[model samples]
Target: MAVARSRSSAGPVGYAVGDITSLDFPDGHFDGVRCERVLQHVREPDAAIKELIRVTRPRGRVCVIDTDWSSSVANGFDHLDEDIAEFFPEDNDPAAGRAIRSRMVRAGLRHTTALPVALRFTSLTDAGVVVPFFNCGAMQSRVRAELIERFFASVERSVDRGGLLFAFTMWIGLGQVPLGSMPRNVS
Candidate 1:
């Protein structure tokens, strides 16, 4: 990858890595692209989606994945799970995950699908560590109750199913380029 990037960057400003909307490379450069958890953060997600499509070869493929907090499972939340909930409040909107599927197809891609996958690790004991990182919170509060409960439940379920761990869903979207449109600038 480094050698490829170096070859692509022939000058001081050659290796550009900033906005996805205006990629440094020319149109139809890459054969495959992966936009993971990136489109949602962009100010103009639609434009970003167009850029991803524009940069790839017409016959290539693009794989996009994001987390959908709205579709999060509640198999384990409860009053005792307050410690877990304090970190993950449902107040914040997860627009990126919710909007990416539709946006990918609208950008002119030929196909799109949402494949939800979950990972559960039971060996993790300090819910505090994982909660702060995943839930995006500090201490405990009613607002974070849901998050806490979910974490507890997920942990319990992980154990019941197997052992103590963390689990969350991942939404995957796939699209293909149009035939006969080979990329031009990317190696």
Candidate 2:
């Protein structure tokens, strides 16, 4: 409702809540489609990517932005990476960002390009939004309480020494639907 009200003063803007893997739009309905930070949470990211390409008209563009959580790094603490892996697990598709480009190409998009973007944070609180292990409260497990506290203590020590650093990479992929071509049902 807020978005609708906010855009009411501006020119026409459309918004619909729908499944990315099965978009309701007709084939070649949109001139451009863009999805951000969503594929990582999806079970079939490639299917969603194909759907994004499907809605775009011939010669139209498709853009996707997603995080490669496997590329996440925390410089201040030891064993932090292992702990994160144990907590989050690889089944989350931590490499989704790095894989979208190839997925788009395989789906028959032309002129596909992928760019890696490094996101750096000096504050643990800020990094917590993207990396939950950075947030102490978010890691409340009876078995791992001591380990979590120890990790935060190390982070604090690093901050005191001015050595704290957190970084992760996200990828932005762009592809163009070829002219005179219609997207096939890749499902």
Candidate 3:
């Protein structure tokens, strides 16, 4: 038998642990929506986003935070291209989730482009924690380790030159639902 996970009172207001595309709530029921690290795993992000906007009230804020896998690079690795190819066979680049913005826009959302942020690493262990998941591979752990080493070396060099400059890139997109009556058509 599986144990049911209880909802926490400290979580988001009116939040439900369910699918976004088929929300149980009525139309225009939300005042604001914040989605983080969700779209990447979604099978239909566009539809899910549409659901978000549909439920949000007029002038409501919609914020999206996603990571681009394709933009991430193995620092100081000469064969970065080949390494990346071996890493993510599905999408041969670090720009994972980058195209989500346009999809949102086409779905009638007015959102900003993905913003880049930096995550600083103090040690190889820290890099190790992220590299495995980011690389998305179990068979390619050796390659991931090599990349992590190179990343740490670069960070150390940068720190030596300027003292622990920690940064990683991520995109934060914000948009708004136009305040208007819901359309009569519910497709």
Candidate 4:
């Protein structure tokens, strides 16, 4: 409701709740399409990419922004990586950010470009806003609550000891749909 109200205040903008794999829009309906942080959760990211390209007009731009969770680094946390993997699992593409550019190119988009943006946090409180594992309550059901508490405690101690660091990379991919091409099923 807030998003709808905000968009309405901005101007005329169309918004619909629909699946990415099967968009309701007609072929070449939009001049440009942008998707952010959506592919990582989808079961078939390639299909979603195809749909984004499909609805875009010829020579239109398709931009994707996603996070590469595999690139997450923490200097003070010893089991941060292992815990993240255990919580998210292999089925989730933690490296989706790095793979989006290639996926766009393979989908027949031209002039593909990828850029990486690093997000650095010097404190656990800052990282907690984005990384759920940093919040004890978020991981309480999956892992032992005491373990999560200990981890945060250790992180706090590390910060006091001047050994705190947290960084992750997010990638942006930009591509242009080829001229004179029609949308096709990507399956």
Q: Model 3 off-target regions past 4 Å? A: 1-15, 76-96, 111-113, 120-168, 181-187
In candidate 1, residue 136 scores what lDDT? 30
Query: Per-residue lDDT of 1-187 in model 4, one digit per residue for the tens?
Result: 5667675865677778899999998999999999998888787899999999999999999999999988987887666765676666456676899999999998999999999999998877877777777777677766666667677878888889988888889999999999988668577
Best-fitting candidate, scored by TM-score: 4
What TM-score goes with each of the models?
Answer: 0.57, 0.78, 0.60, 0.84
Weakest 10 consecutive residues of candidate 2 by summed lDDT = 82-91
When 1 and 2 are scored with TM-score, the better candidate is 2
Error of 2 at 26 (Å): 1.8
TM-score for candidate 3, please give it.
Answer: 0.60
User: Which should have the higher lDDT, number 3 or number 4?
Assistant: 4
Rank candidates by lDDT, best first: 4, 2, 1, 3
Q: Model 1: how far is 94 from its true place, Å?
A: 1.7
- Our tally of clashes for model 4 stands at 0
The TM-score that candidate 1 achieves is: 0.57
Model 4, runs deviating above 4 Å: 1-9, 135-147
- Give the Cα error of residue 34 in candidate 4, in Å: 1.3
The reply for model 2, stretches above 4 Å from the true place, is: 1-10, 86-90, 129-153
Q: Write one digit per residue (lDDT tens) for candidate 2, span 107-138.
A: 88999999999999887778788766777666
